[model samples]
Each structure stands twice: as C-alpha cells, then as structure tokens.
Target: MKLRLTAAALLFPLLCGAAAPQGAPGEKMRTEKVLRMFLSTSETGLDPAVASDNATLSLLENLFDPLLRYDYLARPAKLRPNTAAAMPEVSADGLSYTFRIRPGILFTPDPAFKGARREVTAQDYVYSIKRLYDPTLKSPWAYMFEGKIAGDETLRKRYGPDVPVAGLQALERYTLRIRLNAPDNNFLFYLATAATGVVAREVIEAYPGQAGNHPVGTGPFMLGDWKRSDRIVLLANPDSTAVFHATPGHNAEDRALAAALEGKRLPRVDRVEVKIAEEFQGRMLGFLNAEYDYLEQIPESMTDMVVRDGRLKPELAARGIVLSRFPVLQTYYMWMNMNDPVVGGYGKDKVALRRAISMAYNNAEDIALLKKGFAIKAESPLPPNVLGYDPSYRSPVPYDPALANALLDRHGYSRRDPDGFRRAPDGKALTLTMHSEATVGGRLRDELWRKCLNAIGLRVVFKSDKKTEIIKASRLGTVQMFESNWIADFPDGDNFYQLLYGPNAGRANYARFDLPAYNLRYEQARRLSDGPERQKLYFEMNQLIHAYNPWVPLTHVLSGDLRHPWLKNYKRHPVEFTAWRYLDVDVAERARSARGRGGNR
Candidate 1:
C-alpha cells in the first residue's frame, strides 16, 4: 500500500504532544522502539549479489554482519573470528597465514529454513565461500574473492561445472584456513566486507531461491519480515548480546553509563524498523514532525533550519540528537572508459586528454552549488582520508578554457567546422558522450562538463539515466565518461587501488584500465606485511594513476545525517557500515517529552 501525505501530515504521528512511555501500551509496547526510516528511492530487489546499489546494500549491511565488522569509529571490529583473531597477524614465511577462529558461534537461519540451526563451523565458512561461486547460483560478488585464495584453481577445476571457490577449506570443524597464492597484507580487512557474509550448508541446500530474501547469517541482526516495496523489519539477534554491547575504546564510558542505567544489559534498542518512502523531502519532513525517531542522510534543505534556529537545535538536543561530522573516504569522480571502441581508441595522448579534462573542471564552484556547501572538492582517486592521498596531487588543470583550447589545438584538434566544433587534423570530430545519473549534483556536473568541453571546441553530448540503468550501461562499455562514487571498503588503500586497477571484480576500474606496471605495484602493496612498504607502493601507484588520469577524480563528498529531536546515539560511518548497536536511541519517552519543546505555535 502507498501513502501520499505531505511532510506536515507525516509528522503528526510522531509529534502527538506527549512523551510515549518506554514499553508504552499500544504499538509502543515493543521492548525497544522500532526506529522507522525512509529510503528516498525504491529498491528493485533484495538479491545481495545483484543488489550492488547503496540503498539496498545499506539495508543488507544492517541485517547481516560479516565475520568482521566495523566499530563506531570505523575501525576493524571483529564479530565472528575465523582463522585470525585480530588482524596484522604475520605468517612464518610471510606467505603462510594461520589465524584463530571464535568457537561455539551459531548461525541464525531463517525460521522458515527447513534445516536445523546449526553451530557455524569452519566448514560452514568454506561452504559459504564456495556457494558464491556456484555455477547454478552465479552470484556477481563471487568474482571479488576469486584468484586471491589458494586452491582456487583446484576448486575451480573440481567444481568447474557448478561451484568455483570450494577451495577455502575447513582444516577442522573449529578452525578455518585460507591459503593465498601470494601474500596480501590487506586481505584480512577485505574479507570483512558486507559482500563476504558466511553461508550455512544446510541453509544453502534447503531453499535456493529464497536465501537472499530470507538470508541466514551470524550477524548482529536477522531478517524478520521483508515486504518488497513496503518495508523490511530486522530483529536483533539475542545471541550477539556480548559482541553487540562491547564498546570500542572511544565509546567505552557511554556504554558503561547506559548499561548502569539498564542493569548492565547491552543493546538498548530491540528492533529497527526501516520504512520505505523513496523521497528526500518526505524523509526530512518525517524527521521534523517525529514520524521517524531517527533518520539517515538527512536532506540539505533541513540542515539550514537546524543550524539557524536555536530552538529547533535544542529540541533535537533535548532528545539527544547528534549531528556528527567526519572526514569520510568517499569520492565523487568521473570514470573515463579508455577502451571503448565507439570512443577513440585509448590513444597515445589519452592520458593527456583525460588529465586536461580533469584540470578543466571547476572544483570550488561544483562543491558550492551542487553540494549545497556540504562537500569538499576532490582532485585524485585517493580521497584525502586514504593513506596515499596527496594534497599536491591536486589537479594541475585549472579551470582555464584558454588552456583547454590550447591543449586541444596543440594535439592537432584545431580544425574548425561550420558549427565551430573542433576536429582532429584527420577531420574526426573531437566528441565524447558525457553521461550521468539523474541526481541534482549529477545534472549540475553534466551542465558544468558541457560548458567546459564546449569552450575547448569539444562537442560533448549530455545524457542522463536512472541510477540502475546508468550502472548497467557502464559495465556494457556504452558510457564514455560517467559519474560514479566509491567509499573505502576498509581503511586500506587497496580498496581504491583494486577498484581502479584492471581485473578486479566489478572492474570499478570503469576505465578498464590495464597497466601492468600499476598492477605490479598494487600487488606488492597487497602482499607485504610491512606498513611502510605498503604505503610506499600505494604512493607510487597513486602517482601513476593520477598521471594516467583514467578517472578524473572530482572531489571528496562530505555528507551527514540530520536526526529528529528524539533520536539519540544516531551515528553512521562514512565507510558505509551503519550499525545502531552502540547507539542509545530512545524514541518512546524522548519524543513524548519533546512536546512543547519546538515552540509549537
């Protein structure tokens, strides 16, 4: 069912002028209040392998926890240990790794799961790893872990017809061993990804098609009720009690205090209710009116009001709303596919062309207008937060139309036609397709791209697609220059390196960039346990990619969520791991007390 109501109407349910008691009668009686949320855009499906979109992935991350999880500050926080207890474990030869696994952990299979809820074993991890590469399953995420492990080839050969990654073996029921053909210092951190959740053998064999929808996991929360196009309800796993409440060093005191108040039991909230509203304005208004006790990715329009009005800010303050700001490792950049045949071949001057275009962009103006003063201008693939990020690696290309024209002219793109578009000396027009998704910033960037290129006498055709279609077009090589964003999977530079390097899964190297030299450096960075050595390799690789300019890295996008007056402990990491485990958001009493707090006229 769809509800169409204005922001004012939506706020009424949440702002009914009294603090609803904790465990109040009626809908509020549930142990922890369900913090309803909005998506702002609808998801087509919940298939984790295929659902690469952020909105869907965000929901999935909340519902499922990997063997490793991130803490409040976005550091590696182990959930279920496998092989290694804590990271930075070096092997005897620096190639052979042996890590410890947390024993006695159980899997929360779907209640509908016909199989018994068995204890998650080392073999379960192996089977789950293999299941991703199962031929019949054919999950796209399978490629992410391919070729990184030992016996990958042997498993591929054995399960060649069905599963390809059956090689990650269970040395014993309690212990797991992953042998890498080469050493990857960053490999352990990479394994802790949302894409790398462990699967149970019985759960896999029991119900094939319904798994992603009704996935069984060892994470903090389990999938309870998922109504497509409506809402998804995730109930906290009572089993994660200890791990869920263990505070990171930073929040140790806060958790202690909250625990003291609640008899030392952890995980303040019982359930998280995610509502699907698919519009930014509606989500913001719902937060303002209190329909939502908490909200993520608060709209820019409301930010101004929160900043200007002390009353509104205090109302939010009284309710324990926290507006957190952090230096996130997210970059919004343009991917230039160098190998597309439709576009000119990856020319001898391709790097020069890409670099020139990168320089031509107006970073300051783009941030100001398009980002609504929320983002920082990015100039390299290495966002400022990444270890290799070079502030001086900033684009040498200033926003100079004259310089752009000169570069094109010097490259023999000087021939002018009746319409005044420049052509190569061979009369081939210097044209390219500039495509972006239909986002407010995307449209602004498209306009900026068109204006700048036209000044250089380059004929650029502007095109926009829905979010999903744009991603599809990029993979098919139909896009020449496309706008895309990436947040670090882990703190390692390898996440950025592998994505821009040729041959990684999803080949986020949208450019299909193939440079053996760069790949060699990236491989070296991955293998060594030496921090200095890895940092050096990353620096060299960053320099090479910057020079090549396969992607015109625009700017690091700075963004945050604006919570409602009553939403407390609402924090999110820029790394894309959203966990309310440590958050002490109390909607029932807080919202009720917030009545007469906002100076209601």
Candidate 2:
C-alpha cells in the first residue's frame, strides 16, 4: 500500500495520550528521555542481510554492531574497533585476515538465546557471513562477498546450502580467520558495514520470515515497537554497557563536536520515536511544530523557506534550529539500460544516441531549479570526498541540444513524426520509458527529464512505481531507464566502479554495461592500495565510462540536516549511519521549545 504523509490522515491526534505534551504523566519524557524523529520513507525491513534501502540500513546501524565502525567526527571516515578487540591482523599477502572479537558483548534478550549465554563470539560472525551466501535469502549485497570470500560462491552455486563455506572459520572462541580469493584492500570496509553485523544463529532458526521485524543484536538500541508504515520506536538496550569517549578531531569543527560528545554513554536518549512522514511539506511542518527533534535531509521543496545564503533562515535561526551541511559520498544518476535495443549497442550509432541523451540533459539546471543549489553537478561516477575523485576532471557530455539533435539526425534518427517526435532508424516512434518512484520529488525529476528529452525531439514517458519495485525491475534488467543513486559503502573508487562491472550485471550493474577493458581496470584497481597508481586506473575507468555513456551522472548532494536546539552533540557523518549513538536530548529544553511553539498540539 502507498503511504500518504498527510498530517490529518497519518498524524496521531494531538489529544491522544500517545501525543500528549512532553513531561506528561506515564510518558518516557517524564524521565527526561525520548528523541522524537520521523522517516520520510517506509523502511523495507531491519534485517542486516536483506536491508538494502537507506532507511532500513539507518535503523540497522543502531540495531546491530559491525566488527569495526567509522569514527563519528572523522572527515576521511577512519575505521575503529566496535565489536572487534582491535583492527584485524592482515597477512603480508593481504589474502588472510584474522580478527579477535571483543569479550563481554551480549545480544539483547530474545527467545533465540534460550538459556545459553548471549555473549558474542567469533563463531557468531562466521555464522553471519555464511548467511550472505544463503541462496534463499537473495541479498542484494551478496556481491560484496561473492567471489572474494573463498569457497562462498562455489557453495552457493553448486552446493546450495548442502555444504558449509570454508573461507570464514572461527579459529578459537574469540579469534576468527577470513581467507579471500585475492588481495582486496577494501575488504575490511565491507566488514564495517551493517550487512556484516553478526546475528545469533538460533534467531534465524526461531523466527523465519519475522527475523527482520524482530531483531536481536549487540548494539546500543533495541527494537521496541513497529506499526508497519506508520511508526517505529527504538528503546535503549538495557543490556548495552557501551560508552563513547571522544577521539581527537582533525579540525576545528570536529574538535567542537568532540567537546560536546566526550565521555558520554551511547544512546543518551532512552527512546527514539520515528514517525512516517512521506510528504516533505508535512515533515518540515512537523519539525517546525516541535513534533520532531531533527529533520534528516532538508527537503528541496522547502530549501528556500528554511535556508538563505547557505544559512538557516533568520526566523528559524531565532527559534534555535541548527543546520548542519556536509557533502555526502554519494552520486545520483540516470541509468540507460545497455540491454535495450534502441538505446543499447556497442556500435557508433548506439553510442552516439546515448551520448546525445547525456549531453541534452543539463545537470546544472537540475541543481539550480530542482535541487536549489544544494547539489554539486557530478562529472564522474566518483563523487567528491571519496578516494580517486578528481576535482580537475570535467564532464565531456556538456549540455548541447543542438549537438544532440545533430548526432541524432546523423545517426538516422532524423525523421520526425506528425507530432514532431523523432523516429528511430527503422521509422518507429522513438519513445523512451523512464522509471521512478511515485513520490513528490520523483515526479519533479521525471518532469525535468521529459523537458530535456522533448528539447531533443525525443518522446519520453514516465513509469511510476514504488521505490522497491523500481529497484527490483532495474536489477532484473526489465527497466529501460531509471533514476537511482549510490552512497559509498566505503571510501573507495572501486565501490563506484564495480557498479558497471560485467559480472555484476543484473545486480548493482543496472545499466548492464559489460565492457571487458573497464572490467580489467576495475579488478586491477580493487587490488591496489589508495595511491597515485590506483588513482590513474580510476581516472582511466572513469574516462571509459564517460565515453560509453551508460549513465548520465547527475548530482552529488550536500546533505543539509536541521536539528532543534534541544538536540545536543549532533554531528553529521559523510558516510556512517551510526550517529544516533552520540546524540543526546535536553528533555527540559525540548519541553520548553515545544511549549513555546503554539502549533496544533
């Protein structure tokens, strides 16, 4: 069912007991706790293995613990030990990695634990990694370990759960050894991701389809209540004894954040209540009314109202709202399916068609008009702030409608129908189907694509589907073209390059681009450390991608998050999602802020 974020329809009644004023009797706020927030989209699920979307992963970051985690205040995204005793010991060959699990860590109470001790061990991580190879699960992130983990792909392809994976093994109760097929420098980064979060083996056996909804992990927060698409609550894990001591920051900004967060127990807020606010306007209004403590991403539609000259509006600033802006390691692009007949081919004509389409679309205009100058026009798949991203690089496909028309005309697409739309070489109407989610922003982006395609005399039609459905269709190679984005799973160029790798086709390679030369460079780059030599390979691969035009690199967004004054020690991470741990709420201050704002409640 489609979620509608209308305040009147979705918001709980202000008079209801659950919506009572802060510090009200029987509410968690009475104890000066509770962090209220909202989710703009419905989460797919909380299972780390299958949670692919940002919403689900965001929650899982707190619900589960990875061996290593990104330092909250680090700009370059430094990895630190979380569940591991320290960084894994790597062999000289870089193929074998050994990790010692931290002791005293226990999973939140669950039926799966039965009467046994809940202490996390190396065996738990071994069991979790094996789940990625489970064919029945069909995890989108399985590609992260597919051929890299020794014997994993073979077991999945040949044995099909009949045999165990030989690569990941628990050497002792506390030690785990992982053998990779090749030297992968980014392997540790993958382990730091939520997808590698260890789960209890018994939990999977106890709750089959409901494991995701009923999560049991060794993290700061535990799942409390979930009302499908309406609301989700995460309560502080009583079993958690984790405390965060601030690490030295690299800059003044980092130092300031560290000063505010130093020596604090994880999950300062006792509870996190996330309301479903699908509509941007409603979400922003809710924040203004003090119904929410923080606004995740500043809505593009409300950018002007909330921000002026890169600063929060004077009115909002007066109300004690703090705005944090940082360039995220993500790239939003429009993918052209290489498998489609009209748009796909290795021939000159087909390449010209794709290049023409890329040139016709103006990313600068999209940023100014649609994104309100909140995004950087991307010239390559690798966005700024990630390794191998070159600031000097320029996009070869500039906005040139005349050049686009000339290319199309020269490529035998010159014939125009009665309605003025260009026809294919075979005299068939050249109509392209672009798929997008049926959200407000999605519709706006679709309209922009329609405008640009029409300028080049090409007819464009939009196919609106749920975000999950569109993603599934793209992975299945059923969608001709679609809008999508990739946030870096790690700070490496290989993460972006692998999206076009031939073997990854029908998975992360939604464009179905299969160039042998590009794949070789990607493999070579993945094995090398981040340096000038590896950077050269990245540049070369990016050049090939630019010429191929499988995707029209759109924008790299500067995430703008607004937090109420009562929210303390809030710092945005460029790549990490576990920032909630360091955040603290001033309950009395929040009550005053809410009381001062005489809206609805």
Candidate 3:
C-alpha cells in the first residue's frame, strides 16, 4: 500500500530519525545514534551511471535501489530481490528475462515531483539503465551493456517509451523485460550493480548538470548534508519500506545478527557521516581517539600498531575495539597498457619484454614490505572467493633477475647506454615509466620498483600524481604502466577475466590486453554455466595470460576492519557494499566514551 506521505514525512527520518519505530521502553531516550566513519578516498559524484570509483558509486548504494542485490550477510553472495517483487522469470532460451518491481515504492520526496509523489516504476528503471549508455554522460560502465543488450546501437541508453527499442521494455506498470543478444547467467548479477540502479526521470529533468549534488531515490537513506571532499551526511528515508532481515548464512555472525535485528526498520542509526581523510595517520589517530566509530582497511603502515598477528592488540582490545579480518576478493597488480607503442602488442618482442619485466619484479617482497605481510601473492586472475579459482595453480613466471636479463637480451634489448641501462632493440632509449599515488605508501613502492628494475639494468621512473589524474590518463591510454587492483564486483571468475577481454579495453580492461584466442575463450566460458567443462576454459584462459604477460599478478590483500565496542550488528559482506541500514550504534556507550576521551567536538 502507498504510504501517502508528504515531502517532510519522507525526509524527516533521514534528517533526524524522528519517525523511527520506538525501541523497548526507556531504551529509546538516548540522543541520536550516529555511525561515523572515514572514507580513505573522496567520492566523485552521485550519478551512479557515470561513476567508476568505489567510494563514489557506494553513495548510490544507499540512495538508489537496484532490481536485485547480493545477500547482505552471505559469502559468495547470492542474489536477492531489492526493489523487485521477486526474482526475474527467465525463459528456456535465457534470452528473455522479465522482472516485476514491487509497487508502492516512492522516490524520497523532491521538488521535481511538483508536490506529487513519484512512485518507482518499470519505466524509471529503463531510463536509469539507459543513462549508462547516454553518450553525453560519458559513462565508464557502458561497456557492461555494450553489444550484450539486443538494441539499436544508434538509440544507445536513450530508448524511451515511444522509441522503438528491441531489448528493453516496460511491459506493464510494475513489470520490465530485458532481452539479451546471447545467453549469460551472470547477467542477473549485473542488475545488482549500482550502475543500473533506478533513477526518477523528474529528478533528472529537474537537475541539469548537477545531478551528482542532488540525488533522489527510493532506498533507505537520503542525502542530508554534503561538503565536497570533506564530509557527507546521510539520513534515513522515512517512507522507505526496507526492513533489516538476514537470511540463514554460513557463519554465526549472521545468525546472531538475524536473531537480534530481524524486523527492525532499516537504517538503525539516525545518521551516517563519512569524513574524507586520505592519509593513514589521520584516520588511525581519529580511530584511536574515539573520534570515529569505524576504521576500514587500516593501511599497511599502521597495520602493526592496530593489529598483531592478524588479531587486535591487547592494548587496543582493552579499550573494547573489535577487529574483523578477511581476505578481500581483490588482486593487486601492475597492468601494462597494451595500446601504447612501447608496451602494447602481442608480438614476440613485446610479449617477451612484458614477461621479463613481470619476472624482474618481486611479488613476495612487495607484500612483505609495502603490505606489511597482510597479503598473499596472487598466482592468477581470479581472487580467492570467486568461482573457477584454483588455489593449486601457480604462475609459470617467477622472480629472477638473471632470467629476466637473458630474456631481454634474447629479445634484442642487449645494447647498453652510458648510464648502464639497457637500450631498445632499435637502438632507441628504453625508459619505463610507472604511475602511482603520491602517498607515503606510494613512495615506498616506488623505491622498491626502482631498485628492482635497476637490478636488471633497466631504467625506470615513477610518475607520482594525484590518484584522479593518474586514473584519467590511464583510461585515455596515455599511461604506460601502473600498479592497480581489482575487487570483485560479483563472486564470479568472469568478472576477473573480463578485465582482459578485448572488448572491455577502456572500461574494465585497463591493461587493454586483447588477444583473439583469449577473447574467444572468455566468450566461450562466459556462455557456459559454471561447471567442470567451463572450468577447463578458465584454465586455458589463465594459461594464455601467463604465456603473454600483459599483467604482473602481485598479491591478494588481507584487509581488516576496526569497530568500536559501541557499534553493533556490523560485519563485512563479501559482495554487498555497506550494511549501514542493518547496523546499530550504542548511543549510551558512545556518549560515555566520548565524555571520557574529551569528546570529538
């Protein structure tokens, strides 16, 4: 049933949580509960369709509702309906899929509705997905939909109600249908991503170029306050129908949370404040001083101070800080842009040059020195939790300076310049450049890389710039090589392999590695259901990567989170973003600690 709520009714909960359901008698008398944390990086904008940065797109996770979402507590995430009434019905051929969105859901009240409520509908979703392909948006995620959705390329994401669109359709008021050019089981997982989250047409029309600053959605939270690059505050959506509930999970953590928090109105905390602090020391100090309620992924530099042997130190544990450690579904590596003249190509010389460089760099040393022993050397494209990942598989290449030198010499990089550096086969200067962030950790990595390259008589330099600038240059194919990492979007091997897919060059394939054999294998593997036969293709694809090294597989990071004793019902989701709606803050204990610690004011 529609709530028939007014604008103030829709936003009051987000602003002050005044409409929140009352707790047990006398327990609800405390001040507003706030879940305060810090984001290591700054968010770019609110438009999910255009955003690729993890931090920026996450804002949409709370604001916009997607058709499906990964289970909040389940590992190797299972898809569950978010705004959808239930799972989409798939045809036998798997080309046609139909989704029935839950009715009565309304976008958080906005002036764009002209005082009338804008209930979310199938049309809104169609428009939202179209935004990703809108050429004007310059969306980085368009690659996910490109050539997959059976539609006229000329229409792009702008397929409208009157426009004759073939693949996407709003069949009924609350029903949507998506037709794919080919069969793909992973397509359902793509719907869960923020890139395809629904947006109101009225909101888009109202806000012209500044859609990022002004966001409206039917999710459990609303944008309350924002200060660019400094602080952001989110309030609970008063009219939201979302409630906190956990499914039967693999661990005791989810079971306990389910028992204690089932049926609670979403966004248990009154407000969420994210402070953008890029430096490790600043975030560490804030956590220690009780200025922040959570510290996510404590940087390697401070890993020893906060954790010992992967456990919280006794000194900090005495303060009642809780530690949760998990091997992140991510792989850190250096990707050589395959389009660049120096590094790009599938020729023998180019392949040998890349393989030699990969062998020259030490993964174990980088993990120990830069990651503070909090990571395992990655052997393949897929990280630990993804399907088709084989832990037994080891990389054919190993760290050996002598072998790297020999490989380079055989490839005709034998001439030496006056500076004791190797010259290209064509007698031209061969100076390799790498891009990294200008941070303390980045500098340490630079020192290690420079020393390693020099060991093989190869001249190398690092271009340390702002992270945003480096990313832009890399996407434009200007950067030669850069150490980067990819965290799983969904718990599937296809997600990792797609990074090297020739078609995904500028999007997920930052390395731009496009070999015909690898692309064909990826397509074949992607079409098959996850099983033994598909796994055989996975093995072949990974071996192809080893044969022609476009990427240097580094390490799979072991990340840990620190939560104050006052925080409750919080745990990391393997695939889901933040469970802030399911999280609880102990207002009384927080106040007591703040008073004792001289208050974070």
| Candidate 1 per-residue C-alpha lDDT over 59-137 given as tens digits, one digit per residue, 9 for 90 to 100 | 7665554555654432442333422355434567555544455665666644444445457676666666665555555
TM-scores vs. true structure, each candidate: 0.81, 0.92, 0.93
Q: Where is model 3 poorest over a 10-residue stretch in terms of lDDT?
A: 1-10
Q: What's the lDDT for all of these models?
A: 0.61, 0.82, 0.82
- Residues 1-601, candidate 2: write the lDDT tens digits: 3222122212222312235586667754235377888877778767898887777888898889989888786657788888888888988988898999888898877656665658999989987887877766777778888888887866777634335667778899999999999988888899989999889988888988767867788888877777877888777776665677556556886687677666666877777888888777889888988888888678887888798988889899999998878788989999999999978878888898899899899787899988888898998998998888889988877899999999999988999999999998888888899998787888888889999999999999999987767877887788999989998888988889889998888778999999999999988898898899998998888889889899999999988888899888777777775477777888778767767875433
| TM-score of candidate 2 to 2 decimals | 0.92
Worst 10 residues of 1 by lDDT: 1-10
Winner on TM-score (1 vs 2) = 2
lDDT of model 1, residue 538: 69
Global local distance difference test of model 2: 0.82
Best by TM-score: 3
* Worst-scoring 10-residue span by lDDT in model 2: 3-12
lDDT of 3 by residue, 1-601 (tens): 1112344754574355454456655544446777887777778878878777777766788888889987776665788888998899998999998999999998987778888878999989888887777777777777677778888474664543345567888999999999999998799889998888888888887888877766788888888778877888888776777876557566776788887877777878777888887788898998998778887677888888887776789988887888877788888888999888887888888898999988989887887877887889899988897888887898889999899999999998999999899998899999999998888778888888898889888889899886767777877888999988888878899889999999788777889888999999998998888899898999898899999998999889888788898988878877666777778888778877778777743
Tell me the spans in candidate 2 whose CA falls farther than 4 Å from its real position: 1-32, 115-117, 159-166, 250-253, 256-263, 599-601
